[model samples]
Target: MSRLFLALFLFLLIREKYGYTNITLTVNYEKILAEVRKEFLSVSLDTHLIQLNWGGLNFENQRVQRYARNLAPAILRVGGTSADSLYFKPAFGKELASKNILPCYDPCNCDMDYKTVETFNMTARQWHQLANFAQRVGWTLLFDLNVLDRHNGSWTGKNAELLFDYASRKSVGPVYWQLGNEPNILPHFYNRSINPSTLGRDFLKLSTIVKKYKAFQQSLIVGPDVTHPKQDMNSSKPMKYLRAFLQAGGEALDAVSWHHYYFDGRQATADDFVNITHFDSFKEQAKLVCSETRRILGQKKSVWLTETSDGYGGGVRNLSQTFIANFLWLDKLGVSAQQGIELIVRQSFYHGCYGLLNPNLEPTPVYWLSVLHKRLVGTQVFNVSHNSGSKIRFYSHCGNRKSSLVVFGMNLNNFSVGVNFGKELAKVKFRVFIWTEDLVIKGFKDIQNKFVKDISFEMPPKSIAFVKFRKLVGVQACK
Candidate 1:
């Protein structure tokens, strides 16, 4: 009896030492649920789109440009809170006019020169330079125009006319025009609210102005770029504002646009950065927007999440810039695509705390995640399922170019978990990319030769992996 007891203890210890909880993932490639658009993994460029100099050149540092080029087929939106206050000067030596500017907002105010209206101005020459830069980087510009002209109760088109004229003269690339930024929250800053009817009329007038120039006529007009509608007491205003805007001007819009942030920057922590539940709120917001747009327009129009990130106020210090943020970033992309969102423009490319690149234009973990997403995930989404519960989330997509299927999995557990691809893909070798806590990307590698019917691999705690099956069976979508 003593010998048997000792043997049992040794067996249990060995099992605990090298054991891994098995997880099986079943993917149905035949179900063609949705098509992820080519411009799915795009980003936004805020009002501080470029660093301008006195010589009127809009420039990006070489490092910034190099990092940006990796994430191509991207959409760059040049608008934010600063956009509403931007003063566009078409020519050099223009005298500073008092009426041309307004008080810059929170983030912009910190660096603004209060004495001159030129503090947040962008010259026409700078605009041309920006256009050239966009062309070189394979990005399409979604430029915003100032609409807070107090001289008229509605939007003013003077600066827009100048921009369009300059673009036409220089033969700049196509620019999607967004009239204003977050009109719903304008009341909080400007202490004035332009009602839906007034805004619709303004959009009509702006549309007319855009048509005057051949270059502008070819561009899309998307607007009422409102803030996310909240569920609490403060929600009524933005919700009502959107309903009214859609009712009045839904016909004029080529696409409906809005913004979202998972948490408030001031209160966010590292734990909050990896919390998967935070992503549910974003999906709910997308559903609300989709439902509202369909009801107002009598059909579903293309919806664009023009600006978004983990936290709103420039993001939390260590959380947004670290490897933890990749969980939120990649999950957001997967959820946004599943929710039928046409395009999701990440809040920033190279500005603010939530930016993919830091102030020095160095790539952050999120930037590396974006690069991998662009390379692995394609425009077609496949149905993926796992019984391992919420701690392990799985998303699959058709490969971008090869006859392959890409599966992205996030392991939020502290201990290592094993993922089995099942008998169908068991014999197939996978190209795996793992994003770890140290922000190091373990490039693609094949599993060992021993596993023929299943591949059992250990996933580190709080990490994400991208696995590509070189030739997945019955995935007609990739063909």
Candidate 2:
């Protein structure tokens, strides 16, 4: 695990300008995590990443770095629905009982747009572009197999397998596989009402055939990509079918995959993303699925988030730029890490309220926070103490031989704090940054305004700020 670093501001004029604000951070070099992480950890992403089709990576060919960096090597996940549309062309659309393919959209007839023509004009080439980009960036592939094949109620893994072979033919390392996006969401997505047992059976069958491919020995097979099995608000609970699937010889599967929306549903408000207390409500949901898997599969397997976004369906504009979004992302990451899961793939690097970065490749507040976390927080558990006001909270990462204090304080109100970090005085360095306004799409001033020069300032009405500190051997500290 790496500590995420947040860039406060890089002065264009590289000479350390004097009269700079002395924002002090306290670090205790004496304590570090006792349990060293044997393996380095990072994120995993869906096939389509930020700046790709949905977010338009080459839309303008802006050629900025990070939006693409968001998906490379560090994370690998397949974007399901988007891929389903292209790959799930119904060869026999009229015969299927389900209105759409297993994961197809409302306008099931789009198949003719591409199916009628061999070129697949309707396919989201953006995904191909994404895979190409990932490949170019030295990434591995885990292309999602088609669950919604065009011939009604029928599906095949041939095209998908071939697609993976095509996508990563020139690349190195083991390829990964997932039969469907989220099988639990299958019935609702395709307008079919199959129970979990049927979905599981289908998944098992799909996995069985896929494993026969030559790549099976070298690739990763992940399944049971469900979302919210606890309430079963709209689909069949996977546990029932999962047991049956395994009973029917689905053991060739390598990993358990799924999705999680902070609060189930889309287009939610920022307030919805910010409420951590609501998470307590989902704990039992996590427990149930984990326990079920343990009962059937065994303990200590792998659990991954194939998809997750704070607000729904990409989300609205400003919520992503709010204090709420900041707290929400942090809460999610902390929870996921603390849960001790194997990997967590963020919903997207772009296109949603929870996008770590924007379509233009600029870092969102959450992106900065995410970077900060990657640079500072490690596998070590640190004991922390802080006050929980409506917006601000502070905590310290307790390491066995070194400690780092992270104080993410939200000034939702009119006041600020001047704090003290114990006897580790004169051993801290600071990095501070701020997000003061919403992202404006069509404003000239929005693009031309001078970057702020002030160091200490009031947090704008809904903005979020980031300040980080690295403890050194001889830095001075506040009394």
Candidate 3:
């Protein structure tokens, strides 16, 4: 017995030195912190400023709607760069107005007058169609109102009021409103800037319009909707903008909103997706936002990441669309929820380089990962810790239905590693599901009953595993 104990200790010592030991994952089921909100995972769409009719056309497609419905009970945000300059046509059935169609050398800035700015028109029929689709898919519409119209720095509320009036008459599914997209960075793209006080005043004006309508009275008003923070002084910093906006219009906001991207798409790589440090940095940034929100709004308001993908600028062509993106996607879900973010709106559902569904309306690897996350992980988030290296990242949540606890692990290393659940859980039966290279999904049966303390399995390189335990002994949180 003494010799056996010595040998086991030496084996563990050598494995630890070489970083080959089984990762001991500890889940404290009793330590439930937050109830993950049902709408925590949502999606957004680019409206192309209502021009090109991208928003109206995409949701109407049967295949697109069907794929979206799979992730039901989500928030569908319709806005992007185009939202900042979107124009409205209030006259019902009026012929669509034509733009000057300037041929500017710079794609970012196409200088034009107010008449040309109203490039896209959302007819009454299209509005009704979008509303009906939202209702059918069990999603709420988060419509972005243009703040940069001819009204100057302030929102005139004419087009917004018209939209609300139409929505109320049609009884659209609970429509929430965001003032604009990436307001902090507007100067860089549109050569226009609105001070926080001006934005606050505009929000108040919109709120007054909303209160006049019966259907919109209870609708949420979320904003600032700024881009992520930047280190450079020349770039826009969302936190600084958020502080100013909250001070000026803090009373008007229902939720604080912002966007995040891991890196620039031009330089992004698959290795970046699996790097644990990259996710750690993201968590720190989220923490900073959380701290700022508490300082400004106390506990009354919640923070939301309204637009985020693996990389900005449409995301990397191959990395963002392939199976490796799941590592970043899943990690974002787990870490964001843990950091107290109320919701995470993925940059897009479709119609972008980083879309979860391809142009053919087929599910991408990220979409499959999302389906598994929604179906397996429940509302309650449990505490999970790891004793191994950074290559293995672990998260725990209460199971969806029959299962008691769901454990998710991401293997970032190039080699397989074993995962041990400790002796207390050795006898328990677990169902395992894996997503790896080429978007392949595989499942394995229960671990053999003979194992006393740990279970050894080869978690392939750059893979993720979802392990569900049948029952937990005394987890009141699961109940």
Best by lDDT: 3
Measured against the true structure, the TM-scores of the candidates, in listed sequence, are 0.85, 0.63, 0.86
Instruction: Please give the lDDT score at residue 368 for candidate 1.
Output: 76
Candidate 1 lDDT over 1-479, as tens digits, reads 99999999887677568653568778777776567568788887767443233112125656556666778888888888767777677785443323434322232122433224333567776676677778778888888888775465867687777777767887557788888788887765555677877887788787788878776777888887888744333733666788888888777888888888887776788888767588667777788887788778765577788889888767777767778888888888887776677788887786667878666557777887788888778877766787776778788888887778988978987766778776476656776666678645422122122113225466777878888777655677787
lDDT for 77 in candidate 3 is 89
Q: Specify the poorest-scoring 10-residue window by lDDT in model 1.
A: 442-451
RMSD of 2: 11.2
Tell me the number of clashing residue pairs for each predicted model.
0, 38, 0
Ranking by lDDT: 3, 1, 2
- lDDT of all predictions, in order shown? 0.72, 0.47, 0.74
Number of backbone clashes in candidate 1: 0
| Deviation in Å, model 1, residue 56 alpha carbon | 14
Model 3 TM-score relative to the real fold: 0.86
State in Å the error of residue 40, model 1: 1.3
